[model samples]
Target: MRRGLKITLVAVTGAALTLSASACGGKKADSDDGGGGDKKSLKIGLAFDIGGRGDQSFNDSAAAGLDRAKKNLNVQTEEISAKPDEPDADKESRLRLMANKGYNPVIGVGFAYTTAIIKVAKDFPNTKFLVVDADQCKVEGANVSGACFSEEQGSYLVGAAAALKSKSGTIGFIGGVNVPLIQKFFAGYQAGAKAAKPGIKVLPPKYLTQPPNFNGFKDTGLGNEAAKGQLDQDADVIYHAAGGAGIGVIKTVGQAGKWAIGVDSDQYNQPAVAGVKQQILTSMVKHVDLAVYDFVESVANNTFKAGTKQYDLKNDGVGYAPSGGNVDDIKARLEELKAKIVSGEIQVPTKV
Candidate 1:
């Protein structure tokens, strides 16, 4: 748990400054048309996780942000699909490639790139690096910004929804990793469920962490299996914090003739397994797209900042997904619970 302490640095111009690597120039980075700048072209590079694109979870959400960086920020962007074991290889290779090739700013997705970003950032001190969901990587280089989302805050609302909607007294949560971020989601959901139903029996399943496989994030089959186990135990609904793995939870719920919740983005509309198109009760959303796009824009304008920047329910960064599965009654209850939480009437559990 190496955390970089906040340091103050002077910019030589006698300007009192923070030691962090905050982008100084206000110049924006856009590359929409042909070649980025009237002066020079801007390029952006991305490294996807092991599940790559089809997982329909974290990687997909990150890709959506990268798409925004391309279209809105107008930066020529390239993505490298990372496999289970070699996820960081893409980050290392692409970071060096982009810096060496004169790319203004490069983006690395997921925690797998934490060490890679630090190593590459040192090699190319001139190029800027933005790492998403890497709050732990706080190296004091003059060119790095860390991005993360408050997943727990969003999970609380969905927990409330699940509790209210479950005809059975049982509901469950399956997580990809047992880290703070994912565990926080489970905790908040448990709190929400308790708040709504007073004594909701929620099953917490461990999809990863015991074995500690990097590919657990992409294990759709494993996710489904875990969710199925919960459903078989009579859980009416299941909430999933697995990345691409959540797709399996979605499938299990739909196929088993039960219900499930989604994370990151809206899973209700995405086409998954057989006939489970809309089985998702609702999704707990963390707007990683908005955060990633904002970082790209910031880097282009040369005003990116470091340190822990939190995106929570208040910032619209995290919340319950819209009820696309026609759970109007559940949505109403969720909204009510959301209001209560924000108003300090309820504290979503965020710890074991």
Candidate 2:
């Protein structure tokens, strides 16, 4: 029940003819010939959530996938970004625009697009749409696919690393927004840390902002202030699920000579945080790139399935990055925990 039936031929071929006729000024007739000049070219459209490409986190991971598809598959691509507090209408408009411009398999890079994808997919029944981090769209139709991940599973591994490497026995978690999604990260981290070091002192989690105030995901100053507050309270090791804002957390930890765990992408290898590389103990690596690439590849091969595609620890979709060589000694123990989680021996919590 994961995927809907393949769309009928009339929807695909008729829609393509209509679009081509409108675009080509009736110069070319719609031919049913397969391959040769009759084969349709693939084009992908990406709608990034807040903290777009340069955030060095979530959006960057998706972009990496598109870049790979462009190189290996020789596909054309268009990318758009969401502004802070942008309304759902704006997202819908972006998707509509992409589909109108003949972009197939349009992707919305974050869960915020759940509403937009649900509304827009019905109008353009021929074009395929992919929404990352949101699975509700799967029930909408045969054209929408959701790419989700078990973030808690990855967070658990890094949390254990933080607990094991902490000298003060005190750790902190900084979340971008006080929402269920980010809470998953905190919940897993706390559970893992406690499991690694019993009775460890964990500071109360702090969020930069709540709903209607998404600046938490992009505000570097807020992240800096939050990390400094935690450090002042004797929390020597901190992990952040903020997007662009995490740069400040890493910087503050480095300047304070403490450890900081990264999320979404490997902050240790990111050039933006090169100066603070050593302080980044490790990052919960979420494979957004792999998911994006697979979706695009499926479209190229005419095997695009519309449903939920999950990335979890067992599938190598989410994992802890080996960075700075700081966690080399404890890698074996982390691997053991990973195996346990994959086998359901350890259940990581997704709620705070």
**TM-score for all models, in order of appearance:** 0.83, 0.88
RMSD of 1: 10.4
Q: Once superposed on the true structure, which residue ranges of model 2 sit more than 4 Å away at CA?
A: 1-39, 135-139
Task: Give the clash count for each candidate.
Answer: 6, 0
Worst 10 residues of 2 by lDDT: 2-11
Model 1, runs deviating above 4 Å: 1-40, 87-91, 135-139, 209-211, 343-345
Per-residue lDDT for 57-115 in model 1, tens only?
77788878867665554456555556555544545765676577676677777776778
All predictions: root-mean-square deviation over Cα? 10.4, 7.9
lDDT of 2 by residue, 1-352 (tens): 2111111111122112112212223223323342466555576778888888779998999989887886666456677777788778778877887888888989999888987997899999999888898843243678888898999999999989999999999999999998888888999999999999987888999999999789899999999999999999999899999999999999998889999999899889998889989989999999999999999899888898888988999999999999779899999999999999999999999886
lDDT of 1 at 294: 83
